[model samples]
Target: MKGLILKDLITLKSYGKSLLLIFALFLFLGLSSGSPLSGAMMVMPISIMAAYVTFSYDKLSNWDCYACTMPMKRSEIVIARYFVTIILSLLFFAASLLSYLFTAVIMQNFSEVYLLIPSYSVLFGLIMILISLILVLNYKFGPDKARIALILIFILPSIFTALITQSNVPMPVISESTIMLFCTIMPILGIAALLLSYLMAAKIYQHKEF
Candidate 1:
């Protein structure tokens, strides 16, 4: 898992500048607004781009065989990718907090909206986790045809929601006792998604001819 993680992190090297720009821009605007919602909005594209990077890394490097040959269990590699998603999700959550702090320091917000960040971050994290996992599944089924995975994971559901719901999804129906409900439930969902992804990836990896 550590090796797999290190390998993925290394992939970040090529896109570090773009990733930093995404984080900085979102962090800047989020802090300026003192709005978690805004912070979440800023986090969206970053998550999407990050997922793309995660999906594309191995095929582009032709490293699937190399990864399989390493001293690691197939499950470990999948777990590492899941870990990558969680870590990045947490990073975005932290960025949102930094945004809140920035706004507080700048005196740009009339009311503190720090609390709004977590739930929304969780929601976005869920989306990214599910999207990325499904991409892994599709890529597993067919190698060079992975481009379709991006569309299914990232675009199709969004387009369906937009087409059916007119680009707006309603807010959660739960009571806002505090951040705990939203934050707690989201991490649970994310963990579930990650575990499922790992299992599926492990199954696919073991059977994959590469």
Candidate 2:
């Protein structure tokens, strides 16, 4: 698994400049525009791109076929990929957090919109859900069908934003108890989603022909 992660890190090094540029641009926009959501926006693309690019690299270099001949189990390969997603997601989450802080400093305002929730937690939760779903779809559908994953990366976020906008529910002011409940539950749900996604991917990979 460590070697597997190192391999993905090398793959990332080959194309990571573009990812950095994208995040920087978004960070600047988020800070300049005084929109807290903008930084959080970059987390999704960074994660999905990381996952898809790793898979794409494997296919392009015939790494999957090569890896099967190595000593590692198929389940290890699947879990390693899951670890890569978590690592990349955390990296981008930190980038987004810095952007949020810069926005607050530059704007001299830290409103309830920014303070109602730990923005990093929200972005992290969203990334976990997005990555889990995307990886499962990628495994089940395969790379030539990657358009499906790409479409999903965009669609799910849009739908979520739309639902929030159309629901017309004002953002609620939470009691300490409510906040505690959410803090406890959200991580559990995220973990459950990741575990389920890993199981799904492992099952798909087991049946897959090299």
TM-score to native of every candidate shown: 0.72, 0.81
Please report the TM-score between candidate 2 and the true structure: 0.81
Cα RMSD for predicted model 1: 4.1
lDDT of 2 by residue, 40-146 (tens): 46766767677777777777899888888888799999998899878877777666666666666777767736453654565566667777887888788877697
**Candidate 1 stretches greater than 4 Å from native:** 15-19, 27-36, 110-114, 128-132, 142-149, 152-183
Q: Write the per-residue lDDT of candidate 1 for residues 38-155, one digit (tens) a residue.
A: 6546555565556556766677777777878878777777777777766665576567556655655565563646546565747665665665565475547544466566566567
- Which lDDT values do the candidates have, in the order given? 0.64, 0.75
- Candidate 2 clash figure, as a count: 0
Worst 10 residues of 2 by lDDT: 112-121
